[model samples]
Target: MSIQKIISTKSNLVTELLQNIAIEEDWAKIEQFTIALIDNFKDPRILPGLVEKINTLPFDEANAFLVYACGEYSLEDCKVFFDLWIELVAMGDFHTASNAGFILANLPEPFDFNERQLDQAENKLMLALSKPVTEEKALVIKEVLELLK
Candidate 1:
């Protein structure tokens, strides 16, 4: 199939998966879909639409999908993930922030962070660490902190 066709097909798949998540709240399906999508990680033609569709879901669900996307797909230009991550952090969604931080901290070669984004991430991480958080979230936060350091 043509690249455009492949992207279109995958984009449709993501949209369907998002709908299913909304109707069923089945996170397992999200994971499965993410794993499949990651196979095409290098071809990010669908990312814009996928991210937009993900944003329409509830915060928790949207965050979950985005976290998986970040972890699984290490794109060269990851402004999409970076933007969403910053937005999530600004919204005080620490769990998702941790995932985003982890992604940024481990971004692949040719994808280094700029000083301002790094500073913003550090500031957000510090703020999140000071807040009351669940044990699971604390662990994630610590992991991201260690990676950033």
Candidate 2:
């Protein structure tokens, strides 16, 4: 169903779990394929769901869905996941961590950090750097490290 129709029907699909801990299926239903085309598609209803469960959801699905969220989110909303991004960067598996690192870099402008966050980011990036990665991902991680400076 189209997002509007799904929303209009109160389908218990997107909205019910949108601001809470959604199951994987719940996130999968969001109109991710077309979300960007809508532009200005900032559905504030998503605020808590994205924050509360992003790291735990399946990465490929969550990552794709989150790209749209990041595109529309205000810097403050983005901050709620700020520490989660840093933690994701430290994961040992590239499959699990790369997209999180990608999102971390692409999150709203400034992605401003307090002193403790900066310290934590530095530590996590250092751990990430110690693992094997393609040059492309390394560059992405490096860019985030630069932002911390």
Candidate 3:
């Protein structure tokens, strides 16, 4: 179903719809929903639940979209997204890892990282870069490395 139909319905089913779309690997619908969620993040009623649902998704294209959507959140509010991103990076989902890295690179607020945490992130990125990845992923990895520097 179209995101417009889901939004117009305004049913509590938005989360369910998102879950189904993600499970079904419907990238188009997920992108549409991500845009809608990002646009409406200021709405108190929608943000929390949406973020929570996004967090529940396994690392995949949907989670990549979730990371992009979570980019609109404050650093504090984005901790969960960061955690998921790091995990995904370690597990080697190149698209999600690269997108998450981009989000971290551009976060509006500074995220304080301990030396060990910084080292770990650096190691993960370095390792990922060593492996074969698409040019797009490599570009994002380089951008993230620049930010880390």
Candidate 4:
């Protein structure tokens, strides 16, 4: 199938678990993928390089799907995972950040910090909302806060 078709399908498949966890079927393999992704985040490796290419994919859903396929990440690898989450947040892309937050929230123990731990995250979103609200960004913030709750 073409890349566009794949992305369309992936977007359909992507859903927020518990309205919190962003998951796809491949979530079963997340731990393994997380290990590798973490390693790649810290030190470049062959697989990570390929994963980077996958992440940069123009199709937004495609990139997010790749993250799901990797499975549950080990929390020990959380620093890198958290970094990715922050980066996604900083991107100021609501859909992307929402997806990233759901994934980060579901990350198994060691990685999953308390809601309080994300004081900064909450603050950031709050500040973003402090400005004139665009309907789209407003909705995104709503979705994000609900997940955080």
The most accurate candidate by TM-score is: 2
How big is the positional error of residue 2 in model 4, measured in Å on the Cα after superposition? 37
- The C-alpha stretches of model 2 lying farther than 4 A from their native spots are 1-14, 17-21, 24-28, 32-45, 58-62, 92-112
When summed lDDT is taken over every stretch of 10 residues in candidate 3, the lowest stretch is 40-49
Evaluated at residue 103, the lDDT of candidate 1 is 62
Q: How many residue pairs clash (N, CA or C atoms closer than 3 angstroms) in each of the candidate models, in the order given? A: 0, 0, 0, 5
Candidate 2, 115: how far from true, in Å? 1.7
Better of 2 and 4 by TM-score: 2
lDDT of 3 by residue, 1-149 (tens): 99988666655455555455446446687677656655643444344555565556776665666665666644456554554555555443567766677667665566766788767777887887888877777777767767767
Deviation in Å, model 1, residue 127 alpha carbon: 1.4
Residue-level lDDT tens digits of model 4 in 1-149: 99999766644433212112223235445434444444433322323432454444553544554444332333334345564554454344555555565656566655455666577777766776777755765766656656555
So what's the TM-score on candidate 4? 0.40
lDDT pick, better of 2 and 3: 3
Model number with the top lDDT: 3
Candidate 1, superposed: residue stretches over 4 Å from native? 1-42, 77-80, 86-102
State how far residue 23 of model 4 sits from its true place (Å). 28
lDDT of 2 by residue, 34-121 (tens): 2432243445555555655555554443454554454355545666677776665564245435555666666666555679978988
The residue pairs that clash in candidate 3, if any, are: none
Model 3 global lDDT (CA atoms, 0 to 1): 0.62
